[model samples]
Target: MMRASVLLISCVLAVAGCSREPAAPEAPAAVQADPAAVAAELDALLAEWHESELKANPIFATALGDLRYNDQLPDMFSASYRAEQEARERDFLARVQGLDRNALSGQHRLSYDIFIADRESSLAGNRFPAWMLPVNQFGNYGSFMAQLGSGQGLQPFKEVRHYDDFLARIARFPVLNDSAIANMREGIAAGVVQPVPVVEKAIPQFGAHAVDDVEQSVFWGPIRNMPADFPEAERERLTAAYREAIANTLVPAYAKMRDFLRDEYLPKARTGVGQMHLPDGKAWYAHNVRVNTTTDLTPEEIHQFGLEEVARILAEMNAVREQVGFKGDLPAFFEHLGTDDQFYFKTEEEALQAYRDVQQKINPRLEQLFDIFPKADYEVRPVEAFRAASEAGASYQSPSPDGSRPGVFYLNTHNLRAQPNFLVETLSIHEASPGHHFQISIQQEVESLPAFRRFGGYTAYSEGWALYAESLGKEMGLFTDPYQWYGRLSDEQLRAMRLVVDTGLHYYGWDRQQAIDYMLANSSMAESDVIAEVERYIVIPGQALAYKVGQRVIRELRNEAEAELGEKFDVRAFHRQVLVDGALPMGVLQTKIREWIAAEKAKAGA
Candidate 1:
């Protein structure tokens, strides 16, 4: 799983005259008097918007290797913040409306469209009270705070000021926590509560932060690992300050959040798991589907498509079973695969080593399929124990743009059974190497693109590209073993199952148990793994659907490109065209590729 960008759907870019101008403009025109002037104005607007966004979302800035706002934290769940954001979007739209996007050419025109699309999508989402349903099984802002403060995430602790920056940030956690509770209270009254299981899973996560022993807390990490270069006075003062901050601010705030969830929120949370359970939930889910898939496919269509994919992939898995000489039907073979120790790892170290080994073997082989690579490298690590239980089987965090941080591929070691031995190659290909680390890092490294394009993404394009990369394992001279090929099928089947289960839960009124049962019967996943995945889709609707939806579109485009160009079709060139501009909406990607195919055809005739 790729870590989500905090800036909504795409980058919420703005036309900045609203901030810099003496007065708001009356209305926008379809065309401006000057096209060159509009392009220059847009460059200024994008730069201003980038700085404004980074300042508004300090955590995101820190993650991106920008530290100008390291000492700050926003009250993201507050009503004032909501109003301010809405006004900002309206202001931006108004400003953009004043510009002549059609008059611009090339990337300037594309940027203008994406900027408007993001602002419009964000404005549309304001109808749903997301702030009311902030805390879920996956930690929200409060959890993000803990990740940065732990000194093991994006926040650096090398210098004394780094410690001070954290201290400044942690002091504000109470306000954010109080605002979250306030939002939840309003949500409860408005009937926009999270589901019971989501709250139940979250209750323990909140309590974990308020441990009685401050020294033993995750927040104490930076203090423990304080650099030796610090002056004795600075270190002592920082230690005392951290001790006070953790005991006074963080612990009590967390305890209050824990008590609120356990006593107040849990009782009020709805029993149903679907987003469809809330007011205007169906529309809200449709909005999410549009945001996640970046397409207009309805739930019914996606659900049926998933069913077909499940059957097709199952046939492939059965082919592998035959190759291995297993005497069983598909369902029986699934049971056997889950039960057989040969398919399982003995230790966490062994599983981690398996992923690491794939990295070493595949790194040199990537040249066969691609010509470009990221300047920043990536490392493999176990998922942090605190959040690993609720986390995916594996996830990737992008490296800092300045190369201060290497990308991290976190393999969940919470359950060895969940991390099957056969999955290392396929999973590795998805999370690291030519998957997220490559896509994200390369985008960041491209200095010519706008900051928003460098950092922002469409889920379908990025996730689809990763899944397509998994299919490339065969072309790369890997997946040589039949079981390794089965692993690819297993991963594909998981995405296909998501399309079915996500829609079933949200659109068709399927219960939690029914979704879990669908996954278990359809795939060889362990029950624990199956439950985790179902619950993941429960908390985050429409996200799981991105993988298969994106993969199918990307694969279709590649196939078409191959057919159009024939023997002249260069796989490496096709990949460059897909990846060169960072993530784009699927429709936009299709147009771009078709135009490229036309150009290639013209070149052949000439």
Candidate 2:
């Protein structure tokens, strides 16, 4: 029951920049300067921002599972929406910039930095026409909302009014779908259309949503699963309304969008792989890099890091190949490992079942490594069929703050081949066990952190920890099988490749073919998986860099703690220190851990 909120992942960041060491403390403010005033201002601003943003992107409101503005669909792809976002960001930035940072203490400083960094990064990204490249086969807004209106995905069917709101929302779909089409058209002319394969994959998704009858739609989940306690009259009314909404609004809107994309948009869509072919392509990518990484590291730096990591991982894979008695060069061995039918699940259901099995296997082991655990339970489910193709191999959705729902680890069985048996261990570790499931749910459940810190996150810090967790397979006693060990290497190698391919396409001027070729030649990835991954890098720049970069930092921090504290160091304590603070910019995270390490050292001395 997590709210339908936007998942705003952003740029890499540098370690903490130096500030003049706390100048001599000033006189204490009278009565501690009324914390209430600051609290009130922040709450008001946050509420206003949410309302305005929801008004501008009603789909966002709906996604948060908020129905207050369900009937409306903002012109998100329009110039007006972009302009308004700019103004809002600038206004908020100016207001916060004027805040007395020095006067703030403890959690207040964290709030200020989180708010400022988020808005500043967003504003920095404004130059990019991200809106134009709107309709992807993945988790883009257009398709997401279609599911919402169809009454299937996140939309609820509790009461008669809820049914009416669902209908009202679907009625607004034509406008939203039209906007997506228009934006895609604009992208086509600008040569920023998604890759051909990705777009082709998108056609069916749009086509399916464009079904002619509401009764045949996925939105009928409510009707099929209606609560038994509901009165007979209410049930009938809801069933009819749901059908009417999907028929009148949902089907027509989808058909129009599907037709436009297939007939009008796709034909004109450019075949270029990178944004560099688009208007302001170079500048657009640069902005994306800055925003996503939260750092000034040029694409060149990330690309080079990727190259080095790939080499390092290849050596590790060679070690595994040696251990497993494979007789061939590394690349040849990789192909064997990737294509072997025994390595893959025979059916999608089998693939999903395998993941559930891992959850059972992992939970017992997790107790050995950690003192803390999330109160929220988690489930292993397949990613919805509609969006699975373009989605990541696997992902975890955090639970609601109030614990109304459990965390969900969605395994993308869209391509069963992608969910090979070897990858199950790595994917489970990353998406469930100590990776996203643990980190996110723990953060959400933390009562000590601010609401923003508990719920807000950074891709590098969050994803970095997840990727790092995959490296702990042996430490957790699960990488006993050499093939599973190879799977761990494969997953790491993929992340390492992201570091290279993403930067190659965005910064180093490598063509799409070059990036694809590099992945094919280097890793044990299927072509379908490789294509989806590279396209992900293209659309979401710098995100690929966070995995390896963040993991490296965490690994290094652990090493430092172990070296510094020797036998006194505790892995569980180290992990708790990292997670308890919630997600921070990597730099802040480093500082906090170092402070903990020093404190432990001091305590040992005492």
Least well predicted 10-residue stretch by lDDT in candidate 2: 1-10
Runs of candidate 1 exceeding 4 Å displacement: 5-33
For model 2, residues 1-606, the per-residue Cα lDDT tens digits are: 112111222332222424323346657873444566776566566556656666776655554556787666666677777788789889977987665555555556656666777786776666667787777776566567755644445565666676677667666667767777787777777666776655676777777776666556777766787778888988888888777777777778777877876777777766766767677888877766654454566777887888888899899999999988888989889778778899999998898888889889998898777888888778887777667767778777766555555678887788877777988888899988788889888987887665556666777778888998898888889989988988998999998888888877776767777988999998888888888888777766666777777788899999999999999999999999988878877666777788889999999999
TM-scores, each model vs. reference: 0.95, 0.90
> lDDT of all predictions, in order shown?
0.86, 0.74
State which candidate has the highest TM-score.
Answer: 1
Q: For model 1, how does the per-residue alpha-carbon lDDT over 251-338 read when each residue is reduced to its tens digit?
A: 9998999999999999999988998998989998988888888777899999999999999998899999899998989888888889
Candidate 1: give the clashing pairs. Answer: none
